[model samples]
Target: MPGRVQGKVAVITGGASGIGRATGFLFGEHGAIVVIADIDKEAAIETAKEINSLGALAIGVGLDVTKESDIKDVFESAAKEFGTISILVNSAGLNPRLPSLAGKTSEEIWDKVIDVNLKGTYLACKNVVDIMAKGGGGSIINLSSIMGMVGYNSVMSNGLSPYNPSKAGVLLLTKNLAVALAPKNIRVNCLNPGFVETPFTETLTSDAELYDNLVKLHPIGRFARPEEIAYCALFLASDESSFVTGAPLLVDGGYTAQ
Candidate 1:
């Protein structure tokens, strides 16, 4: 039996950890040639090695999606290596919760978050359009969040969090690109996930009080698993979603239903 994405090449940014890493593994398992591009070179390589060991074709590359050269190089090289890139998962992103941004000022935090979360997505989408179009069309899955659709509660942040704004930008960007690139045969969509249990949320989840509060917001009584979200990405990447485009598929555990 052929896997859903058999023989297709999927280039995933932020493929070293969290949702990105899980998606890479799922894509590989389903027979796609995965390219794990991330800021952590070694982690990315390790991920690719693991996928290959599982009998999938994959390669890992260090990437800083904020840089156009990095995006160009990774996408082009992946196309060159795999013959063509038919799928792209712009999963690279930043949130105020990142420990690296701990001591940074508000301005610095805002800039960094927006750069990686929004601009990086823009750059990756811009660079991959040509390759996907040339390949006769492909699916692009951007990772947005429930925050992208609605404002966060005051308890989360005095409303100064750049995370929400950056993700909100991603939702609109997905829509714009979907409209502009439809004729080119490329399908663009975004996944607005709710809280997911991944390293990315370790900091907050480690605090029992905060974790409980956050979990209650979901209405499902818990956060999502990384693989659950990856399953959604799989559908978008596969031909089963041929008629889906310019959509924001919410896999947010009824968080937005309230």
Candidate 2:
């Protein structure tokens, strides 16, 4: 029997590490041609090599999602190499801590976060939609966050955290794109996950007390693994979610439930 998403082509942004890397591996395991696109060229290349060593077809491209030229170039190359794009995973994002924001002004912090988290998603979608449509429709998975649905805990962040608004924007963008592309058979959706064990959260998770406090926020009392989130993306990317679109699937370890 064929694997889910067999023969589909998936391009995952931020695929050098974390959830994006995990998702790329999962997609490859399920027989999809995977493109690992990230700003970290060396890491992306290494990831693609690892996937290929496992008998999967995968490639790495240096992609700065915040750059339109880079996004266009990556997608175009993927299309040329793998045929019309079929799946897109917009997983590139940022969540700088207070110290990282220290030197930067509020406006700068907001711009950096919004540019990478929100504008990047929009640009990736904008570039890939035409390819997906031409391929008779496909799946586009955007990564939102539980914070998008609810404000972060006061201990975790201030009320004005740009990460929250950026993710919230992604949630809305997913819905809008889903509705607009339904007629063309393209499915647009997002995943709102709680804290996951990824490089992005290393700063917070490295501190035992902070990690414990963060885990306590989840009703499940633990953080998510990258694979757990990847499986969710696999479901959305496959035909299993044919009827699912414009939906924000929460895989939050019951974080939002509390």
Q: Candidate 2: which pairs clash?
A: none
TM-scores of the models, in the order given: 0.99, 0.97
CA lDDT, every model vs. true structure: 0.94, 0.94
Residue-by-residue lDDT tens digits, candidate 2, 79-182: 88888899999998888673656688778999999999999999999999899998899999999999889998888776778999999999999999999999
Report the C-alpha lDDT of model 1 over 188-242, residue by residue, as the tens digit: 9999999999888999899999999999999888999999999999999999998
Q: Model 1, poorest ten-residue lDDT window?
A: 152-161
Candidate 2 lDDT score at position 158: 65
Query: Whose TM-score is greatest here?
Result: 1
Cα shift from native, residue 211, model 1 (Å) = 0.2
Model 2: lowest-lDDT 10 consecutive positions: 93-102
